[model samples]
Target: MKRQLVEELKSRMKLLQEREKSHTAELSHLEHKVKVLTEEASNRRALVDSLKRRLAVASREKSQQEAACLGLRQDLEKKSQRVEALQARVSASERSQSQLEQTATRQLEGLAQQSSLALDALQGRLTQQSSLALDALQGRLGLATKQLEQLTSFTKALASEVLVEVQEVRSELCRKRKRKRLEEVGDVGLKKSSVSRAQAVAASILNMTPTDLLHMLDTPPDTEEASTEDSRRDQEWLEQVMAILQQQIPAAGRLMEAVRVKMKERKVLTEELAALTAPVSEKA
Candidate 1:
């Protein structure tokens, strides 16, 4: 009975030792599981902090973009207003330019019309004056021709009378020269008489008026005795010469007056032509 009891006790001790070993192994496995769970929780917490930082950065960026959009919109509105103002100013300038051009054109046309009328009037006056001047010249020329013919006839008559008187005097002088020696009655007396007659005739012609010469020519030759026939013929010839000289004076004066009037008209025409051309040059 003692041996059996000892065997049973040993068996029971061995069974208790096996149970303790199994419990120790189970405890070690549970501790390893706890360490792995703690490490996974720490990694999850770091991931959540990184996600929060990324979200905050995205919100700040969104706000900045909105502020930039508002400023761009304000700039666009200001630019549009400036464009409209400039367009209005341009339209006003174009209208004013058009009005000024129209006004200038009308004024130029009016000036042209006035100048044309003035030129036409001046041309008509010039033509009328020229015709009247030409008629006056023709009348004066006819009168001069008639006067010249009368002078020619008077000269011829005077020449014939002088010839007749000179022949008579020469015959008387020849007869006296035959009777008396030429040296005894020196040529001094002959010279003195000839000089006296010539001087007296010249003086009479120079002193006579135009009317006196004409009257003398119209009247018949004076009948003189043999002693005074030579003197009377000389006086008649001088009167004819004096009448011719007086008639020419008035003709020369008329011609000079006509030339002066023509010069005045030419000057006026030149001034008018310059006035007409001045505007044309300025426009060019």
Candidate 2:
């Protein structure tokens, strides 16, 4: 019985030892699982922190882009207003240009008509004045011819009288010299007197004045008849010249009136031309 009891105790001791060994192995496996779970939790926490940082950066970028877009929209609105104002101003300018063109055209047509009328009036006046001038010139030529003929007749009569007087004086001088009969009379005094007398007669026949005759002859003539007739005839000729000049006065007045009218028409035409050309010149 004592031996059987001792063997039972030994068996119990061996079973307890086996149970302890199995429990130790299960605990080591559980410890390894726990270490693996802790490492997984640490890696997941690092990933979550990285994802939160990315979300914050994305939100900031989105806010900045929205601000920039708002500023761009404001600038576009300002530019659109400026463009609208410029368009309105261009339309107003076009309307004003059209109105001005219409006014200029109407004024130009009226000026053209007035200029034509003025030119026609000027032409008619010029024609009348030209005819009057021609008639006046013809009348003056006829009068000059008549005066020239009268002067020729007067000169011939004076020449004939001068020749007769010169011949008589020469005969008297020859007689006086023959009576003296000294070979040649030292009558250089008488000869000089005769030469002076002949020179004076020649000057009178040439229709020179007394003062002019004295310069030509260097002495006085023996006769006074030629000088007296010359003065009387010159006075009569002057009166006839005055009468002819008076007769031309009315024709000169008519010519002056025609010139004045033409000048007035020209002034009117110049003013009309300035008015007509002003608009076109401004555009140029």
Candidate 3:
């Protein structure tokens, strides 16, 4: 029985040693699995950190993009306001130009009317003065014709009947009277007919208006030089006024052209801005 007991104890000790070895092997396997799990977790954590970094960079870029977009938007708004102001200025300038044109037209019309009326009055006065002088000349011519007829009759009678000295004295007296009458008639005749007759003849010969000849007669040594010079001066003044008006018109046109160029530039800027922001807007 003691031998049997010792044999059983030996077998149990061998079994216990085998169980201990198995438990040690199982524990080593479990530790290897834990190490593998730790390594995988560390790798996953590193990957997550990398992804977070990427996300942070993307977010920062997005923020910068948003800021840039905001600046662009502000610039666009400013440009839009500027464009509107320019448009308003253009409209105001156009209106002012229109008003100025209307005012100038009215002034020109008024000047023309005044000139016409003044010219008509001057023409009427000249006509009346010419008629009066012509009538006086005609009367003198009639009296001279009568005196010539009487002298001729008296000379014929005296040649036949009077003494030589007496007839010479009578003839000298007749000659003196004739000279005085001629001087009176000649002076009046030249004054009345010189300008009109010369102008009429010149107009007929040159195929021009008598009024143009009349204006030509307005120079030095002509009958109406003083009045014509005044008229010429008036015409020059009117021309200067017209020139001033025309100059102002061109200035307004130039202003309008400048505005048009500015508008074109604004349109170009707007198109470029739209192009620049198109992608941003699409992303938004």
The most accurate candidate by lDDT is: 3
Candidate 3 structure quality by residue, lDDT tens digits, 110-139? 999999999999999999999999999999
Q: Which candidate is the best by TM-score?
A: 3
What would the per-residue lDDT of candidate 1 be over residues 1-284, giving only the tens digit for each residue? 98998999888888877877787777777777777777777777787878788778878887888788888888889988988998898899889989988998999899999999999999999999999999999999999899887965675465455445454544444344332332333444767466446556765878975445534433335422533764564555455444544564435444344434434534554555555446547756
**Candidate 3 weakest lDDT stretch, 10 residues:** 158-167
For model 2, residues 1-284, the per-residue Cα lDDT tens digits are 98999899889888888888888888888889888988888888888888889888988988998998998899999989999999899899989989989998999999999999999999999999999999999999899878866754564444344434443443444333333432233344557567557657877789876557644333235334554764565455444433434453325454344434434544554555555456446756
Clashing pairs for model 2 are: none
RMSD of each: 34.2, 31.2, 39.6
Task: List runs of model 3 lying over 4 Å from the truth.
Answer: 90-284
What's the TM for model 1?
Answer: 0.26
| lDDT of candidates 1 onward, in order | 0.64, 0.64, 0.67
For candidate 2, the clash count comes to 0
Clashing pairs in 3: none
Worst 10 residues of 2 by lDDT: 177-186
List the lowest-lDDT window of 10 residues for candidate 1. Answer: 176-185
